[model samples]
Structure formats: C-alpha cells, structure tokens
Target chain A: MNDKKWIVLGLILFVGLFSFPFWFNVGKAAPAPEVVLTEQAKAAKECVMPTDFMKTEHMQLLDVWRLKVVRDGVSQFVNADGKEFDMSLSNTCLDCHSNKAEFCDRCHNYASVNPYCWDCHIDNPKGDK
Target chain B: MNKFYMSSLLAIFALALIAWVGAPALPWLFGIVLPYLAVAVFVVGFVRRVMGWSRSAVPFAIPTTGGQQRSLPWIKQAKFDNPSSKTGVFVRMALEILTFRSLFRNTRMKMNEGNRLSYHLEIFLWLGALAFHYAFLVTLLRHMRFFLEPVPGAIQMLEAVDGFFRLEILYDSVQFGLPGVYMSGLVLLAAAAYLFLRRLFIANMRYISLPSDYFPLLLIMGIAFTGILMRYFTKVDIAAIKQLAMGLVTFQPSIPAAISPVFYIHLFFVSVLLAYFPFSKLMHLGGIFLSPTRNMLANTREVRHVNPWNYPVKVHTYEAYENEFREKMVEAGLPVDKMPESAPEEMTEEEKE
Candidate 1:
C-alpha cells in the first residue's frame, strides 16, 4: 500500500499532462473572425477569378497572378468566362474594392493569412494606416 | 556482421535526396500525395496492430517476477518487480514504459584475468535509448507550429522552453533568430549514432545483430539527419512549409513552390519510416503496453488460476487396475486397497448360485 502511492501520483500527473491541451483550451479560444462585405464588392459586376475559386484558392491564384504580372510583364488576364481584364492589383482590383478594411483585410484576418502583396504594394498610399 | 548497415543507410539517403532534387518535375506526387498516404497508413496500421494484440487472451498468471512474491505477512515483498496487486502492476508498467526501468537495470558480462566472468552495469544503451526517445518527442511537439494555423499556445510555450535550452544558455545569452538551433535534433542524432556504433563495433553484438535490427536505427537516423540538414543548411521556406503542413491536416493539401528540395527528402524519409513502422520492431512503441509479462500481477499465491482450456483426461482407475492385476498382486504378496477374490470362493460360487 505504501509503495503504491507513487503509482497514484504518477497516474494523476500523466492524465493531467496529457489532458493539458484540452484543459488549457477550455473557455480560451478566440472567436472566429467575421467577413464583412461592403458596397465596393457589391458594385463590381465580376472579378478576375470566379467567386467560389476566389473564396478557396485565392492565395495560390494571387501568387501566380503576382509572378506573372510583376516578373513576366503579363498585365492582362482572361477569365474562364472569356472576359479580359488588366491584371494589375493596385490599378484594377483595388480600383473597385478600394476599402481594404471592407474587403481584403476581413477574409485575410479571418484565415490568419499574411499576404506579402502589401509589403511592396501599399494598400493605402495617402499617408494613412 | 557484414558491416552493410552504413553503406545501405547512406545509399538510401543519397538516393532519396537525389529523388527530391528531381522532384520539381512531379511536385504533386512527392509533396502532396505521399504525405497524405503515409499519415493514413500510419493511423490505420497502428490501430489495427493494437487491436490485433487485444484479441489474444492471457489465461495464466505468467508475469516475469524478479522479486519476492506476496507470502507470509512478516516477509517483505517486492511490490514493483513482483507485483501482488493491480496497483503494483500499474506502477511497474508505468516505470517500464516511461523510464525503461528494466533496460536501466541492464548489465554486461566481462571475462576477468582469472577466467572469471563478472557483470558490470551497462548504462550507455539505456541512456542513449532514453535520450533518443525523449528528444524525438520534444522535436515532434515543437513541429506543431508547422501543422496548425496560428499554432496552439501550449505548443508555442513548449517551443520557447525547448529553444531556451537549445545550447543557447552557454553562448552568452545570444539568441539564434528566426529558426534557432535546437538541441533535441542533435541529441537524437548522437544517441542514435551511439546505439548504432555499439552494435556495429562490439564483436558479440555484431555477430548477434541482424539486418532487421540495424534497419530501424538507420531509417530513424536518416530522418533526423535530413531534418537537421533542411533546418540548418538548405534553409527551407518556413512559411511555405507551414502552408503545406496546415493544408495536409485541413484535407486541402497543396504544394508550395517556394519550398526547398531538401524538405522533400525529409518528407520522403519520414513517409518511408511511417509506412515501415507497423511491421518493424518500431511496433514495440505500442507493444510495451500490451506485453502480458510486464502488465500482469503475480497473485497466484492469493488466488487460484484455473486454465480455461482444462478438460477431462483418460486414465486407469485403481479399481480397474486391481481387478486386472489381482493374480500378479497376490503372487507378489503386495497389499492392495481392495482384496482379490480367492480361487476356492470362486469354485463354491456354482453351489451358492
């Protein structure tokens, strides 16, 4: 009985440590970030990519669009719907969705993504945050 | 015995590294498909193996007792080595699993000048094995940042603690920025090397060691080496790797182009190891818990252990034996439990009937 005391203590510790992740998570996770769409997105009739594709694979698509437009000097993108549009982010995409807070930042923050597009291309150039 | 482990290990690593270098042509297969397949196999195979072990029933109190059993109340019993109750059994099993207590008690035999063989404490194998397993666990926990979005707070704290002791305290409090140096990876590699060299160099151990014994060590070493190389030498794109790892867990796996070729080699080795783990001695990771000899209590003195398969067996009864050997027994003047019938009595039987 005396020697068995350590077993009880060890068991308590084992269960405690293994379950720490779950216990620590209790009443503690951040609530999901919300996406808010404004009139800027509502007024734009179409986007360079389809809406669903943009929703899921927008990062990869943006990566490819960045490489081609910046490096290869290919500024025009033909959508699957056979509509050609300028592939410039600052001039074409931001032209319609100028409010970064209403559009880009919402979904990006929700997904916890840090897109490098803003590193070189400023989201706001009028000395604004 | 043939010293083939090192060459085979190097060949496998070099070939895998070459394949990774050539992976750009078919990035999807090596990067996306194999990791998913390996993880799937690891989960299903591990569960199946454990379930298979559970199906067998232990019908005997066959624990390997190394100490005194529970007897007279006056005599002290070894509660752990020869456990008499479930609690003692639990403690023994916990010690065996957590600290490899049995292995820690390992001894080596050495022939003395007087031709007398003596036993010496062999702590290196135990120490190396312990260090290897513990460091591997820490490294694995530290890798959670790659697989989770934003990473969990506990994992972050663990990573910070691990980095704090990453041989950084001795370097004048200088912190290695971005991806700092990790001691766990290096310690795992060193421990594995010690285990490997011990088997390879020792004559008796080398003679007894088989290809199967060396295979897992080599495979694990290859994994650690490649992982370290990618971390310190080639310098993989950390963001791309996180994206890839997160994607796999999310069931939306995608290969990031910015990821280096070295990372692919690391992934390839890991996949091979995972797929091979179920059938290899690596299954010992799960078997330590299931072993009846380690898990069972020595309670035979306090309780009866009836064999479930016990059944009636044919044997000659004493009455039948006496009846058949009555003449021989009487001739030999041997006393029997029952008396044999006399000849005169048999002759009078006709008149009596």
Candidate 2:
C-alpha cells in the first residue's frame, strides 16, 4: 500500500469528524426537555390555537402577531374558535405560560433556537415568585 | 426518457414510498435500525474502497500538468498547476478540492457554418458544482444540532449566517417569519436541480449520462424536497425530532410518535445515499486524494521512478552463445571468439581422427 500511514491518518480524521456527535453524547442521557405548565395554563385547557398547532407553529404565530401588533397597530387577534385576545406576547400569551425558564427556554435550549423575541420582550412580565 | 434515469427515478420513488408508508408501522426499522446499518456500511465501505485504491501501484508520475513544469532555473513554472514538490502538490490539491479549479477550465465547442470550430469558456458547471457541494456541506453541519445533546454555539452561529439572507415569505398559505428561512437548503435544492437539468437538457451530456449519475442527483434532490416539505409546508415537531436524533447518537434509540412521515422519507433517502456512497461514483470524495494524475509530483525528469512490478528474467549470455556457435562460425569462415580444434592452425588429437 503506497502512503499507508497518510491514508490511515486521513481515514481516522474522516471517521472522527463524521462520528463526532456520537462520541460527544456517548454515555450521556439526553432526556427530552419537558415543559412545565403553570396552573393557569393547565386550568385554561387551551391557547390561542390547538396544542398540536402551537407545538409546530408557535413561532410563525408569534411572527404574525408581531407584524399585526407593532406594524399594523392591530393589537386584537381572532383565533379559530372565534375567541378574540390581545396580540401581546408579554401581556397576553406570557400571562398563562409565566414560567419562561421551564416553558420557553426548555424547548428553545433543547432545539438551540435563539429567537430574537427575547431581545425586547421580558422573559416573565408578571414576576410572580 | 432513457431507461437508465427512468429506472433510477422509479427506484428513488419506491424507496420514498416505503419509508413514508412504513415508518409509522415499523418505527424501529426506519427510525433506529436502518440509520445505524447505513452508517456502518458507509464507514466500513468507504475505508475499504480507499484501501483498495491504495493497493494498486501508481508505477508512474502521471500528474496532469496544465502549466510549465519545474525545469530550468530561469524559466518561470506554474507551481500550483504543475507541482514538482510535496508542498506544491499540497497547494494544488487544496485549490482543486476547495475551488473545483480544473472544472473552471471547462470549454464548450460548436461547429460553425463554414465547418469552423469555435470554443467558448463554460463556467456554469463549475459554478453549479461549487454551490451544490458547499451548500450540502453547510446543511450537513447544521444538522449536527439534532445529534448533539447541548447543541454547540458554533453550529448555532453557522445556522445564523446560513440564514442571514432572511426573507418573510408566505409558504403554503402560512406566513413564516420567526426563524426565517435558511439559504443552504434552498441553494442545495436549486443547485441539484440545475445539475440534473444539465444532464437532461444538454444533448451531449444526456447522451453520455448513465444511471449512476442520475441516481445520486435524484436521490439528493428527493432528500432536499422532503426536508423542505418538513421544514416549511408540513411542519414536524422539532422537539420530538430532536429527541429521536439524540436517542440515535446516545445509542438509546426511540421513535417519537409526533414525527411526520415526511421526515422518514428524508431519512430514507439519506440512508440510501450513505449505503450507496462507497459503491457509487461518490467515492470521488476519497478518489480525489488517491488519484495518481492529481496527487503525484510532476518531477519524472529529476526523480527515478522504478516500476514495482518489474521482475528478473533468465537470459543466455553472449559468451555462452559464442561457445555453442564457435565451430559453426569457424566452418563458415566467420569471426570466432576461440580457435576450434578442427581449425587449420590448431589441430587436436580428437580432430586428427
């Protein structure tokens, strides 16, 4: 085999880089981040949309809300169930899901999504202990 | 349509349908089992292919030189193009791999009205190839977020940059704006489409293109389409997807119920790609380095390259030949190395009889 040492070295690098994630998380338990719902959220039993819709498309909804409220000056939103609510993340949505660390950060951190929403809006507007 | 690409396209469609329909029923197979098997085959097969290539001796310095080779001290040499040293070869290989330098020199020929030939520099193939490769690489790197438990900051930063050209567009009647749209996936899809089109639309390319060529392009395009479908059109549960990804890497596999069948289709295409890589022309990933014409030094004039396959052969010496033919030579009045006993000048007892 010509250039045996170099070929072996190259192969090692290739395998090491591709299998990085495996070795990085080997022997480590990666439990799915569980969101803790506040009592208010639990009692309400519903959100602006269904649980499944919110699970996949909460970000898109938030974007639509931001455009409507801040840009269009339309603070009132009408949901599918003909339910009307204020289009404010801090005042309306966060009112029920107040536990930002457990609810928002849990999944956000798990998915590594750095939403710019936190740049302006407070994590917890209610400041309940 | 040629039977080659038609069969290839059909095979891809069949594979996709299998995963899209079968994943829910056999989650363990699509989610856990096939991915592991595919990776194993990919790694082992890739190494074996490389080793197989290395076993065959180069036996010659056949670097494809495009510039002046190293020669006279006064003559200026194209160091990178026609490398004579290891360092030069390294730089050349780097440029070749990184930039597709050779492809950039592509030219198109057309016969004019008067039987005259005209050449035009072709750059689209090189451009398409470059875009396809880089976008694919970036997309692959960004996917690491799923496998890693605590997704690294570097990957997050890469994601931010890749999606820097953010646009707010209404896709499938839903306006998406929060995460924006990553450019790598779109670029990959577009570039793949372009490459595939090149083979289909171009007369010469279409004639020469084989099933092997179309298969990978179609497979990758299918992978991209399913991925885009999951990301934008039919949004899958990211958290559940992440959970499944983490499970695979941690060797504690699970199939989350929330995952969409589209993900399975995408995964199926990816798995097929991995398994097919070493056996297909995709081995160019490894072949580029082992290619004798690209990697060898163009210093055949200076360095003596002995063929390793040369062997010793039995030969009759001139002295043995003269000894056997000496009597015949003396009789024929031809020059002889030694006087024969029957020669007129030297008479022997045996010859006297």
Candidate 3:
C-alpha cells in the first residue's frame, strides 16, 4: 500500500513538472519564424526539379553503365574510378554518390529538417572512390 | 479466452470511455500526467520482461530446420533455409529482420482438380507487412532531429533525399507548408489497417486470430488515427510541440501553451502505446533474440544428451544373483555349471533368491 502511494505520488509530481510548459507560455503567443531560401538552397531545389532535362542524361549514363556491367558478367568495382569494391543489392546507389556528406548535408541543415533514418542506417559517405 | 486479450480489450474500452466522459478535463491528465506515467512504465517494464526471458532456462537446441541436416558429403542440403554455420545463420537473421524473408515466402493452400491440395503464392500480406514496417522505420527516422541537439549530417542527407522531389515552384512561393507530405506515415497507416481488416474478415485468419492480436492492431490503428488527425485537421504549432519534445529529451520540462489540445490527444495515445509495448505482443521485438527457431542449431541427432532430471537408482547385478541361484538351478534340473569343469552361469536377483 505504501509502495503504491509513493508510485502514485511520484507520477503526480512528474506530470506536474511536465505540465509546466503548457502553463508557462500561457501569455505568450509568438508565431514561428518563416524559413528564407538561400541561393544555394534555391540551386539545390532547382537541381532536384522533376522536369530538369539534365536528369535524363544522368539516368541514361547510369543505365549504360549498369548494362555494360551486366553484359560483361564481371564484378563492377568502384564508380568510374577503378577502385576495388563489393557488389551487393544494398550498396547499388552508393557507387555514384560516394561523398554523400559533402553533397547532401549542406541543404538539409539549412532547411532545419529532421530525418529519422540515422536511427539504424550507417552513413558510408566515403566509398572506394 | 486468453487473459492478455481480454484485459487489453477491457483497458482500451475503459480508456475510450474515460476520454469521452472526461473530455472537458482531458487537458490536465491526458495532456500531462498520463504521458509521464506511460514512459516510466515502458522503460521499467521493457527491462523487466527482457531480463525475465533471458534468465529462463532452455536446456535443448530445438532450432526449427526446414532443410537437410548436416551429414555426409554425398547428401543434398538446403543452404539458405537450414544454415549449417554461424555466418549462414547471421546472414539468414539479417535477411529475416530487414526484409521479412520468411513472410515473403508465405504460401496459401487451395483445393485443385480431384480434390488435390495445391499451394498458391500469397504476396499481398508480405507486401502490406513490408510497407507497414518500412513506413514505420522511415517515420521513426524523421523524428530523430527533434530529440538530438546537433543533428547528424547523415540524417540530414536522408531527409533531403526523401524530399528531393518536392515542387520547386511551391517551395519558392509559400516558403513553408509542412515541407512535404511524409508519405511514409500515410502508407504505414493504410498498410496496418489492411492487415488488421484482413485478419478480421478472412475466415482462416479469423479462426487463428486471438484477442491479443486484435488489441495491438487496434491500438496501433488508434495511434495512427490520432496522429493523422493532428497532422491534417488540427494543425497544431509544430515549433512549440518541438520545443516541448526537445525539453523532454533534455530533462528540462517546458510545456508551450501554443501546443494544441489535439496534440495532447496524440501524445496520450503514443504514451499508451509505449506503456503497452513492453507487456504486450510487441515484445516480439525482444523475443526474437530468444526464439529457439532463430537462435539455436539443429545438432541434437549428432550428439548425446543426458536428461538433467535423471535420478540415481540401485541396480541388481547378474553375478551376485548367480551365486544364490546356482543351488536352486541344480535342484530344478536347469542347465548349471559342473563344479570345477565349467563356468557358473550368471543370474538376476529376481530369477535366483
């Protein structure tokens, strides 16, 4: 009985502490700050455009490389850089985007966005290339 | 029939009623107190359950093998299904955890011509399950930025990659309108609902389905529903909610008033899920490690196993019995050894004196 009472009391205290946030800002109603896109952000956004004609060329090059590897029946090591590597289904895309940290992180931090992927995925930004 | 299911149903119904009746007073308890309690319960309960499972004795290597056992070189083997080595087992476990490989191979039986049984490939369940799990994973990954102070670069990269297809025109014009719709959340809910409904509606599934299964499905659905409501309908202050979440993560509690009551409702449901996860079927997350089928190897046939429970017992030897039986055997005209010419015959005590 005593143990139960203590537990209940502890829960009450914890809840009271958590509730401070709701009550603390009762008088304040400041709106969130608007996000301003920088030149780099605009460039990054443009680079990712769905209708960008350059993407077709990029995709075609990838397809040609894939076809060549498949035809040769040889292990495709590295990304056009002639470095030795393992071939697996998991690392298919990593062949090209070897420097992921350099290419990807700049825009994301600017956007103030959070992504849940790092929970389990390992970032192998620097591959054989 | 099962206590777990019955209790779950009762608790859920009771909570639903409480939420309905105490709607006016929910902001105090549901918004604040319940979440704290749930988190406490989740952490403690998960640890306790895992410890208990780890302590339990498993005296046998009872791995469920679906292929040929390790034997002579001449014999054929099932390499992937019944792995013979540690590396193979690790590979199998990896595939199973990451891709639900076993579920993918699931088949359904049906009657064919002449009433013959035939197996049909059932891929819908696998697809739905995969969608649900991956979506859940993605959603979880997206939420990590709220918890950590200096968000990792890798996570940022993933976020950018995920939202790469966003309309540039909209991005330039509005500047912000919920960035991009997190498709994973919607996909997760839809897939989970499909799985739940299939179990409820399908005959075979319904027969095997117990209340425990239904409860988790319902609870998850409820959580998803509340979350969707918060996102699309309520439109709570994201910044304030993040501040509150960050504060919780930091151990310094500050509840922002701008956070809506609907957000509280969503938090309450999430809290309930956390508390229930440890005690409920969701513990399969931990139980997978202890599963004999997944962890053990099938090597029992090659090795001798002594029953640990065997007790010592006195045994009667034949030689001691023979001395007592020798006189009786000679009198009864049974075959006996000549005094010095032949060896004496051995006998058991029950046969002799």
Q: Which predicted model would earn the best TM-score?
A: 2
- Candidate 2 per-residue lDDT, tens place, B1-353, comes to 79988998999999999998899899889999999999999999999999887777867768899999999999999999999989999998999899999999999899999999999989999999999999999999999989997999999999999888777774436675456688999999999999999999999899999999999999999999898888876888989999998999998998888688899999889999999999999999988887788888889899888766566768899889888877667778898767765655454555567
Instruction: Give the higher-DockQ candidate: 1 or 3.
Output: 1
Measured against the true structure, the TM-scores of the candidates, in listed sequence, are 0.66, 0.93, 0.61
Pick the lDDT winner. Answer: 2
lDDT of 1 at B287: 80
Q: Clashing pairs in model 3?
A: A21-B254, A21-B255, A22-B255, A115-B141, A116-B141, A116-B142, A117-B141
- Count the clashes in each prediction: 0, 0, 7
Q: Worst ten-residue run, lDDT, model 3 chain A? A: A47-56
Instruction: Report the C-alpha lDDT of model 1 over A1-129, residue by residue, as the tens digit.
Output: 122354344445644653343344454333333445446667775677766545544554555566677678887888888988787777776776777885787545433344557879888543333
Better of 2 and 3 by DockQ: 2
DockQ, 0 to 1 scale, candidate 1: 0.04
lDDT of 3: 0.59
Error of 3 at A83 (Å): 64
Candidate 2 per-residue lDDT over residues A1-129, each given as its tens digit: 258789989999999998999999978999889999999999999998999999998888888787787778889989989999999899988999999999999998999888888899888888994
Q: Model 1 clash pairs?
A: none
Candidate 2 TM-score over all chains jointly: 0.93
The CAPRI-style docking tier of model 1 reads incorrect
Put the candidates in TM-score order, highest first. Answer: 2, 1, 3
Query: Distance (Å) between predicted and true CA of B58, model 1?
Result: 3.3
Candidate 3 chain B, poorest ten consecutive residues by summed lDDT: B168-177
**lDDT of model 2 at residue A2?**
53
